[model samples]
Target: MKVPLEIRPGSDAGLGYVKYGNGPVHVLVMHDWLGDHASYDAVVPWLDGHALTYVFVDLRGYGQSIALTGEFTVEEIAADCLTLADQLGWGRFHVIGHSMTGMITQHIAADAPSRVTSAIAVCPVSAAGNRLSPEALTFFASTVDDDNALRRLFKFVSGGLSDEWADSKVQHSRATVAPACRRPYLDMLVTANFVDDVQGLATPFLVMVGDNDPGLDAKAMQRTFLAWHPNAELHVIPDCGHYPMQACPRYFATVVERFLKRHTT
Candidate 1:
């Protein structure tokens, strides 16, 4: 089902969100850094018949929230998700965070343990943060101005998807984001750390990684999430890269559905 986008007051900005399904189980899906709620479009059909309610949200300066502005830090983003949940009158719910939002999910689970039922981090960045080298940071900063470079960067993330897909992703991102939000967020995601913040977090976690995803693999999850959370479990999706949901939507949805059924029931 389609719902009109509603803007809710976030910490220092406004967040836009849309809800789907009518199941009693409530889930909040956070978008990746590259795209907004639309990033999960491929998985929608798979969830269309499920007995769950899924809410897809856009961070400030992205998608429907493109006009909104904020600090864009992980902490602020996590707060926005909680605020949305409150607005929805959901006392507790599950969170499915992809890519950068994966990191944001940790903040949500860490900050409000009692409010979160479970967390699914799909191709997520660990809560401890991903420290990048000065050279790599410089290169990422450059992509803000260079579309071709940005497209090429996604190639690595997608493990070499078709040109059409890459172009569409680049176009959508450029149209929806401003450099002010993009640059600072990139800086934050690459350098921020929260090892102590998430220590001893008991929230049930389902960490999904793509076998072809270069940086965030099963091994990485083992070291970061598995080592940190005693209740966390990792699953590897084969023959796909960072965007497994997009690469194989049905399979991705099936895996997530199974996990939620097991834990959220």
Candidate 2:
């Protein structure tokens, strides 16, 4: 059973979260782009007692949470997450973020080393010279309007193994909350940057990527970026895609469980 919790940052804005297990350390889990806390759905059940408490949920503008007033920037999302942590009384916790959220997790770690015990990013978005394929850019352009019916071309661009998964992730993600989240989020993200210096990263770090991910080079990138950190490690999942949370959750869960047990003091 999932225990639901709500964090109201202010007027008209709230974030939804779930707490699983009971342990000395709590985990602040972030989802990939176009995903909610549900991104961790497949892996949560198995976390049981091993992790003490595993917290995963939708951000301010995704899933059941309401976006804040005015524009929603990447910084805003970051602030909201930190605020949520404070509200939950998690002065210190482990963080596990996927994709865009992984980037944010690093920001948090850099900003507050005392509060973060460890960090994990599964296929983190590129912070430096990140380039999308021409095909991907074209597909993103075509998805500007939500059509009455699903488009096959869109499914191909979104990186799902099946049209069903692609459509569901996109449609639900787009329709989840306020539109400001994207405009501001994108603006802030494009303007800001990330660097993978695990040595600099006070928290122990774990980075994982999937074989099906275009280029499947997240591991290489992680290694190049995090090589300086003695505690940094990387893993590449075979026969999987960008959506490894749903694609091969068993491996995902194991990696997370091990990271937590070994690092968290």
Candidate with top lDDT is: 1
For each candidate in turn, the TM-score is: 0.94, 0.81
Residue lDDT tens for model 1, 1-27: 553333343334347776777778899
What candidate 2 gets wrong by more than 4 Å, as runs, is 1-14, 133-138, 141-160, 194-199, 227-230
Determine which window of 10 residues in candidate 2 has minimal summed lDDT.
4-13
Superposed by TM-score, candidate 1 places the C-alpha of residue 233 at a distance from the truth, in angstroms, of 0.7
lDDT of prediction 2: 0.65
C-alpha lDDT of all candidate models, in order: 0.84, 0.65
After superposition on all C-alphas, the RMSD of every candidate to the true structure, in Å, is: 2.3, 3.6
Alpha-carbon deviation at 159 in model 2, angstroms: 6.6
TM for candidate 2 is 0.81
